[model samples]
Every structure is written in C-alpha cells, then in structure tokens.
Target: MLLNLKNIYKNYGKEPLIVPVLKDISLEVIQGDYVAIMGPSGSGKTTLMNIIGCLDRASTGTYLFEDEDISEMNDDALSDLRLNKIGFVFQNFNLLSSETAQENVALPLIYAGIHKEERNHRADVALSKVGLQDRTTFKPSQLSGGQKQRVAIARALINHPRILLADEPTGALDQASGKQVMELFKALNDEGVTIIMITHDASVASHAKKILHIIDGEIIENKQGGAA
Candidate 1:
C-alpha cells in the first residue's frame, strides 16, 4: 500500500474546551490511484490531507506511509519526507511573485543540491510536460491564472515524487481554467502518478477514479470507478 491510515484523530485546544477535527479515520491508498476527497467547509478534510502529506501528525492513531510509521517522525524528518516523497499543489499557486516560472519550478531541486544546469533542465522538462514551454521565463504577474497553476504543477513534478497531493487546485481558477487543470491531473494519473485531491465541488471530485465523501469528520461514502 502506498498509504495506510488507521483510526486517525485530530484534536485542538486544551482539555477544557477541545475540538475534534478528524474522528477515527482509516484509509488505504495504493500506487497510481487517483483519489478525491470532498467535504463541506470545516469537515476536517484539510486536517486529514495535512496528516497524509506529512505536514501535521494525528492526535491519535497509526499512520503508515509506504509501510513506514510517520507518526513518530520529527519535524526535520517530516520535512524531508514531504520534500523528497510527496509533491504538493495548492490553490493559490504559491509561487514567488518575483521569480520567473523557470526559477520557481527549479527551487525544489536547488534544495536537493542539484547542479544549476540540471535543475534548470529538469524544470524546463517539467514545464513542457504541463504544456507551458513558452512561459518558462514569465513571472507570475505575466501569466494567467491557469498558467500560474500550471507552473505550480510543474514545480510539484520536478522531484518525481511518489505521490501528489493537490489542495483545491482548481478552486482559484475560472471554469475554463479549472477544466484545463483537471484534464492535466487526469493525464498525470493516467501516466501512473498517485494523486490525492481535495475539493468541495462534485464536478471536480468526479474527475478522480475514486471518491471519498467526508462529513462531520467521518467518511460518509466511498465509491470507485468515478461517479455513476
């Protein structure tokens, strides 16, 4: 299994007035699986994604990612795991406003100690894969919303991560741009990238091969082969 989460729970605040976000969440994901998580606002889906992406730990329960226990990993270890094993795409693009698309996509490779030439080459290849070859030198200010998201996607792919976690990737885009991004995600999944996306829109969730509907911190529905 690529991911195995069992009886996970997340709580906040002190004992006097605590809030539980996730409740006994158990999930399993295999390699190359395209999964979507859908829920209303404040339904704890974000919290669950954080744990799966190694950004946060569960308050209780065991999380075994690729059969390795991640619950006990320290902050540095978690950072390494996120940097080397997982790729994240966010709704807001998250690009440095001053950096060119090429530079932004190559940033992760820089942290990995890759040579500048190789980093630039790989970044270019990734951007080309996302069909943004002509926008390599364009800064975020110069690109459209779809182009910025494409740049973010290219950056996520630079490390060749085992799994991709996209948080509302289409949320900040217009209808046409959102459709373009979803198609890109499907194409990436078809090429064997394990993807987990979180969205509130049913149409967006329908793009996944499987859907997990979350409500009140619990998984209310799990369906495969997309929606009927």
Candidate 2:
C-alpha cells in the first residue's frame, strides 16, 4: 500500500469549539490508484487531504506511508517526505509571481541539491511532458489560467513523485480549460501516476477511477469505476 490511514482523528481544540473533523477514518490506497474525494463544504475533505498529504498530523491514530508509520515523524522528516515523495497541485495557481515558469518548476530540484544544469534540464523535460515547453520563459501573469495550471503541473512533476495530490485543480479555469486539465490528469494516471484529487463538483470527480464520499468526518460511501 502506498498509503494507509487507520482510525485517524483530528480535533481543533479542547473547548466548546472543539470540533472533531475525522473520526475513526481508515483508508488504504495502493499504487496506481486514481482516487477522488468528494464532500460538501466543511465536511472534512480538506482535513483528510491535509493528513494524507503529510501537511497536517492527525490528532490520533496511525498514518502509514509505504508501510512505514509516519504519524510520529518530526517536522523535518515530514518535510523530507513531502519533498521527495509527494507532489501537490492547488486550487489556486501557487506559482511564484516573480519567477519564470521554468524557474518555478526547478525550485524543488534546487532544494534537492541537484546541479543547476541538471535541474533546468529536468524542469524543461517536465514542462515538455505537460505541453508547456514553449511557455517556460513566461511568468504567471503572462499565461492564461489553464496555462498557469499546466505550469504548476510541470512543477509538480519535476521531482518525479510517487503520488500527486490535487486540490480543486480545475477550480480556477473555464469550462474548456478545466477539461484540458482533467484530460492531462487522465493521461498522467494512464501512465501510472497515483492521483488523489479533492473536488465538490461531480463532473470534476468523474475523471477519477475511484471516488470516496466524505461527510461528517467519515467516508459515507466509496465507488469504483468512476463517479456515481
């Protein structure tokens, strides 16, 4: 299994506003699984994604990644895990405004201590994979919403992560642009990248092979072979 969450729980605080976000949540995701998580607002979908992505720790229970328990790992360890193993695509294009697309895509490789020439080469290759090789010199402001998202996707792919976690990846694009992004995701999944996306739109979720419906901090239903 690439991921395993067992009886996970998350609480905000200790008082009246102490809301329980996830209660006894258990899930397993193996390699090559394209999974989508769907829920209404405030239904704990984001919380679960945070936990699964190693961005937040569960208040209780175990989180195992590749069969190794990561629940007790320190901040540095978690950072390393995120750097070397996971890639993230956000709802908002989180690309640096001042950086060129190629530079932004090379940032993670830089942090990994790769040589400058090698870093640029890898970033260029990743951009080519996402069909953004020609836009490498453009900044975020120079690109359309879909193009910006493609840049972000190239950035995510630079490190060759085992899994890609996308949160509302198509939220900022128009219908056509959103379709393009979804198609890119489908192509990536077909090439064996494990993808986990979070979206409220059923149409967006339909791109995945599996859907997990979350509500009231629990998984209400799991459907295989696409969205219901």
Candidate 3:
C-alpha cells in the first residue's frame, strides 16, 4: 500500500470543549490509485487532507506512508516526506506572481539543492509535459486561469512525487478550463500517477477510479467511478 490510515481521529481545542473533526477514519490507497474524496462544507475534508499530506498529525491513531509511521516522525522528517514524496495542488493556483513559469516550477528543485542548469532543464521538461513550454517565461499575471493552473500542476509534478494531492483543484476555473484540467489529470493518472483529489463536484469525483464520500468527519461510502 502507498498509504494507510487506521482508526484516525483528529480534534481541536483542549479540555471539555475539545471539538472533534475526524473520527475513526480508516483509509488505504495503493500505488497508481486514483481516489476522490467528496464532502460538503464543514465536512472536515480539509483537515483530512492536511493529515494525509503530512502537514498535520492526527490526534489519535496511526498513519503509515510506504510502511513508515508518520506519527513517529519529527517535524523535519515530516517536512522531508512532504517535499520528496507528495505534491500539492490547491483550489487557488498558488503561483508566485513575481516569478516566471519556469522559475516557479523550479522552486522545489532549489530546496532539493539541485544546480541551476539542471533545474532549468527539468523545469522546461515539466512545463512541456503540461503543454506550457511556450509560457515558461511568462509571469502568473500574464497567463489565463487555466494556464496558471497548468503552471501550478507543472510545479507540483516537477519533483516526481509519489502522490499528487489536489484540494479542489478546479474550483477557481470556468467550465471549459475545468474540463481541460480534468483531462490533464486523466492523462497523468493513465501514466501511473497516484492521485488523491478532494472535490465536492460529483462530475469531478466521477473521474477518479474510486469515490470516497466523507460526511461529518467520517467516510460513509466507497463507490466506483464511471471513469475507472
């Protein structure tokens, strides 16, 4: 398994006023699995994503990624795991407005201590893969919404992460742009990328191989997707 979460529980606050968010959440994902988590507002999906992405630890229970216990790891180790094993795409394209597409794509490599020449080369290759080769020199302000998201996707994949975690990735785009982004996701999944996407849109969830419905901080259903 690529990821395993058993009896996970997350809570905020302390004492008698502690608020429970996720309760007994058990989930597993194998390599190359395309899973979509569906939920409405205040459903605790974001909190779940943060734990899965190694950004936060569950208040109780165990999480294992590639057989390594996440709860046992220190902050630095967790940061390394996030940098090397997972890529994140947010609802808003979090591109640096001051940087060009290539520069933004190369940011992760810089943290990895990669040389400038190789970073530029790899960034170009990643941008080309996302059909943004021509936009490499363009700033975020110069690109359309779809193009900016594409740039964000390219940046996410630049490190060749084992899993891509997208939280409402198409939420900010128009219908046509969203369609294009879904197509890109399909292509990436076909190439054996393990994708875990959080979306409220049934249309978007249907694109995954499996749909996991999360309600009131619990996974209530697991259904097959039409695109499987």
TM-scores, each model vs. reference? 0.97, 0.96, 0.98
Which consecutive 10 residues in model 1 have the weakest lDDT in total? 219-228
Every model: Cα RMSD to truth = 1.2, 1.5, 0.7
The digit string of per-residue lDDT tens for model 2 on 54-171 reads 9999999999999889966889999999999999999998999999999999999989999999998888899999999898889999999999999999988888898999988988
C-alpha lDDT (0 to 100) for residue 73 of candidate 1: 82
Model 2 lDDT, full chain set: 0.90
**Any idea how many clashes model 1 has?**
0
Ranking by lDDT, best first? 3, 1, 2
State the weakest 10-residue window (summed lDDT) of model 2: 219-228
Runs off by more than 4 Å, candidate 1: none
Q: Model 2 compared with the native: what TM-score? A: 0.96
Worst 10 residues of 3 by lDDT: 219-228
Instruction: Tell me model 1's lDDT, rounded to 2 decimals.
Output: 0.92
lDDT (10s digit) by residue, model 1, range 102-152: 999999999999999999999999999999999999999999999999999
* Candidate 3 Cα errors over 4 Å, as ranges: none
